[model samples]
Target: MPKPEHPTDPDVEISASATARELRFHARPEVTVHAEAEPGGECAWGSDRTNLPDQVEPNVTYRDIRIDFRVAAALTDPTQDPSSP
Candidate 1:
């Protein structure tokens, strides 16, 4: 196999970032990423932000989705125990 050109470990100022581009979500989502890099030294860094819809509708299909939840009768209640997961 051909060797990769760039370091997998992102720990330099001379780098680039790309995320959340051309994406559509029916509901708000938790975005999680882990990056290790230093800013400003001898190189340039470019950044792009999360992409949201250009337009939205209220009380329509474009509204944010919600999830309904309730405690099941058969579930063992853990509210009383702080150590419980």
Candidate 2:
């Protein structure tokens, strides 16, 4: 087989992972993987406060989300997406 490329940052050590309880293999075992882009951002927002009789403001932050869909014992397609006819 071929070596798996680095998907996540090498600096972030992966010392723990959940067990795969959903897997059934036979003669020819296989897998399918899917991924999509996620939005991320950070900004500031205004709020209401009664203490100082002024516009209360606070900083906001957003994180990147990545979902991975995997199917066990599946086949891979040469083209990730089928060409339109």
Model number with the top lDDT: 1
Q: Against the true structure, what is each candidate's TM-score?
A: 0.22, 0.17
Candidate 2 has an lDDT of 0.26
State the weakest 10-residue window (summed lDDT) of model 1. 67-76
Please provide, for model 1 over 1-85, each residue's C-alpha lDDT reduced to its tens digit, 9 standing for 90 to 100.
1112334333332333333323444655554434332222122222322332334333334333222211111122334563556
Q: What is the Å distance of residue 76 in model 1 from its true position?
A: 50
**Candidate 1, 3: how far from true, in Å?**
27
For 1-85, candidate 2 gives per-residue lDDT tens digits of 1112432222222221223323322333243334322222111112222222222223322123222222112132445554544
Question: Candidate 2: where is the Cα deviation over 4 Å?
Answer: 1-25, 39-85
